[model samples]
Target: MTYEDLPTVPRAEELVDKAFSRAARAGRAKSGAEAQRSMLQTAGNILSDNLQNVTTSWPDFDRVDPFYRELADAVVPAHGDCPGGVDGLRTHLSEVMWAGRQAGHIRDEYQSKLRGVDADLARKHRKQAFARLADVTREVSEDLEALGEARDTLKTLPDIRADQPTIVVAGYPNVGKSTFVNRVTNARNEVASYPFTTKQVRVGHVERDHVRYQLIDTPGLLDRPEAERNGIERQAVSALRHLADCILVFVDASAECGYPVEVQLALRDELADRFADIPVLTVCTKADRSRDLDADAYVSVTEEEGVEELLDAAVEAVDYEIELPFEG
Candidate 1:
């Protein structure tokens, strides 16, 4: 959705009030399951930016070891004693994962499943084999349980229906904050490699597992005081005061700042004073290009681990609830 689709701030505020009023009249279902679901959905919203990184990576590791263990239970006797049994099982399981299920209802159908075997001569033995499939079935169930747990762990991300999480990406000019948002969110916001490419604050929705968060890509850091008649710095100041839910302070932890870490820390201090209530996350951008950037704080790896961690932090925002007598 675009700016046009979203109500103007004043209108949106009015709607929120109206919504709460309506909610007040309805009886609340304070069930623990309901609360757990709401919280997980909300957390999913905050971590939307990093959900793929976390959730996708999770199932991969989560399923692998269990899948191999299950395979060992099923295949060790028939496929007895491969030199590196676990490793071989892992390789086979990887292939199966990539292969996915067979097409359509045939995937669930078992009639033609033993097609490759010479079943005509081995019918009774086949019956005996089917009876012994219990161990394999049990192992398969265990593997599935591991994958389910991983998905559930991600599904339990923090969320509250009334207030959504917001992450403000602030940094020195050209630190790839916009790119980071795009990578995690599949957002199409414009990005440039120049300082101050983003003059205005652009808010994008990062939704994961049905939860939503507002990812605010703000202008670069404001070094000069507000009193100084300024340029990009002023835009940054405006974003600080008005737009962010939580501040993600992006530093040139790589020090393309042309200055020193002292200057960066001073800037951070100034920002803290200005936006004292907003939580600030330090982000060190430009791992691909700048090696000189030193961040004793959270460092971003040009575009990989650094940006990934930043997104996880964005997802980790706390949610608040008023415990309304009517919430369901």
Candidate 2:
């Protein structure tokens, strides 16, 4: 699930306001003392319940798949706004929960203080109790705001399935990688005629012999070192490193994609070395305008040629991990 689907966490002021608003709406028709007690109880309940819900709704990083957990670990800690990373978020959230519980305790304590006091004085004490609760709530305003910021940052994360056999397509800019994915998977993932057209990873699914494979189309590669990669590219690299069962590196032989054959080869070599543990299949696109590329496979999307070969190679690369039933 995308982080956007996660529950919303209200700011401290908002929570306090809501709790007080609910308290105001609580019944006050009976004895003033009883009415004051009811309002405090209602306010405490509202505060505590809202805090509890926010804590519970957060994604449990411990229980999630490796991909998401790792992704969270990578991003949350790096968030400049979130002081404690994932643990920090947890700590802040825990503090909010504690504040909620304390608000309830404060209400109960003040209610007891109201026991022998006159109605007007009891009303004064109730306001004092709410003020104390609000103080607690306000103290953690930064934490609450940090949590909200973290949520916004996390929502942009791509939703990728960790259970499936996955293939990642990587190469320099404008190498027909997106088009290749569209043609092979029958998925209408966005395709444009410019470099870095795919700013985020696009996922598609195809079933070969009932064994599903997830195809990932990554943004265009840059001819630079990994250490120098920007945040978006680093995220792509992180996902690819953890999730790729196989990688398909494409090259443009005709130089129509702007980068020359040699530059594209350097990129392919770099990817092959980087993901040395996984199988890397290199395919030369733009075969119709071929200018001699020594690739493991070649495909011309415009002429609709060599696509089957590319698909066949992809299936074979993934099929190695598939355990077929033996006929004894």
Candidate 3:
């Protein structure tokens, strides 16, 4: 489900240069029509294999986890010249695959033409085949560029494990969402920017009773309504819908967070309706400053008060059951 291991995508010109350069070396090792045939086969195989590798390196969109699939859809196209949507990305991949097959076909056809031909004629046919192969690659240059851009964007995404129970911490700006997550989880939270957005996301983990729970705090998403968000942010929230097993809707009852309690409650209600199947807990933060509002839990990160209790409540709400082996 992670894109960190995806291979770096090479440009069309790089692939072509590599293929032709190796073909020349392969040609030097033989004579007559054999030399020409060797060169053609060498170049063709390199181009075809490399081009195919680009496509194979990407996971099948249909089979990918819905969370990552949607995240990619939101992030990839926002940076580069890639077309929007998963379908558009698939189209670019299909083109690369087509070009790879074309390279193979060109090799086979030129090999046939080499039969019964002298060294000079064989050399001429090999050149023609090389030209055709390069042409095929050049035709899909934009596709290669788009896929390369996608690789760059997707690789930078924060590594959020889909297998573990996830608690998404959300609230308005300065509502102490990040502070609360930092307090509850380990000291080291992985922070990374979402592609095409100025805001960053923080992810942390807490282990209890031999099981791990993930806590993610995303800015610029889940803090505002869908109508107020841009396309990229909206899609990101959509992706979170698939990943969040439980959501902690933090409300700064003190109004010191710069947002009114009523507004925060409305957002909580909206999230509750949107993720109807998931547990949405309303937490009143900055308890030391003020506890003027009612919530499922209250916490003050500054004083380290009620934090553990809040964490226990979130973990219990997740209710993740670990499967045990059956007795023989």
Candidate 4:
């Protein structure tokens, strides 16, 4: 699921101000005890509904695709003041939800207290309820701020479609992975920065036989050894594991990418071991410059040579089957 549609989380002060302002208008429309009751109901309902909306606006982390779930966890800490994790984010949401319910309870209690009271007494009950609701809201202000930060971070994630057959390109920097992706896919390929990493992830698409395949080039996460990567980068790589149908390990045989062929091959073997369940193909890039390394396929983006064949190999490795409808 895409995070682009997530609603902006409202701050506590903003929510309180909005609810009370709207409640005043409702009170102006009525008279006496009824007016006070109307004002209380309006304000309470606004706070409860808005706080609940903030909680519900976030996609359930447990039910979300693992790729997005872990990626979000890596980028945003669960609590504004504590460490980051899915459970932490859930806790913040839970607090906000509880606050919403408390607002409703306060409304009901004050409404009950207003019964048989005169205009002034009813106004006093309504004011007390309003103060209580505001306090409840203020208590979860940190949670609200955390959710808002999460929304802002998650919304910026690259729109990678988990449904599509994905080919993850892995190699050292300047190994021609990006060049190959650009050459093979349409002009719609996107280069988006991950909030957790300084590097940018390039996503491109190619369609064949009416089925679309996504090519992803993740720089910092996949270009190095597992032990060399930081915790956040490792988590990011773990997230990619869920999206990869096929992994293309690009090896620059010419060593012009500034790494020895041996190092590149070692990374390939490491990935092969890590993603043993998925198909991992070794590709020798920069074929025009040198074809010294043995690989499953060879491609040279400079001459636009063998690029389509390599893409075809990745798709073939994916071996995605089209599901057909059954007729009884």
Which one is best on lDDT?
4
Per-residue alpha-carbon lDDT of model 4 for 86-112, expressed as tens digits?
Answer: 777888889999999999999999999
lDDT, model 1, position 203: 60
- Candidate closer to the true structure by lDDT (higher is better), 2 or 3: 3
lDDT of 1 by residue, 1-328 (tens): 1111111111212322343333233313333233223322232222221212222332232343332232222222212232222344344344223322221122223234333444342343323333332223233333333333323332322121224666667766676777777777645567876667775555667764455777767667756666772434554555456446677766665566454656766777777787788777666666555545444335444446665556656666434233448756
RMSD of each: 23.7, 3.4, 3.1, 3.1
The lowest-lDDT stretch of 10 consecutive residues in candidate 2 is 77-86
What is the C-alpha local distance difference test score of candidate 1?
Answer: 0.46
lDDT of 3 at 96: 97
Q: Following a full C-alpha superposition, what root-mean-square deviation does model 1 have from the true structure?
A: 23.7
Name the better of 1 and 4 by TM-score: 4
Prediction 4 global C-alpha lDDT? 0.82
TM-score-sorted candidate list, best first? 3, 4, 2, 1
* Structural similarity to truth (TM-score) of each candidate: 0.44, 0.83, 0.89, 0.88
TM-score of 3: 0.89
Query: Against the true structure, whose TM-score is highest?
Result: 3
Model 4, stretches more than 4 Å misplaced? Answer: 187-202, 222-228, 256-258
Cα deviation of 132, candidate 4, in Å: 1.7
Q: Which stretches of candidate 2 lie over 4 Å from their true place?
A: 1-5, 73-95, 138-142, 152-156, 320-328
The superposed Cα distance between candidate 1 and the true structure at residue 328, in angstroms, equals 9.4
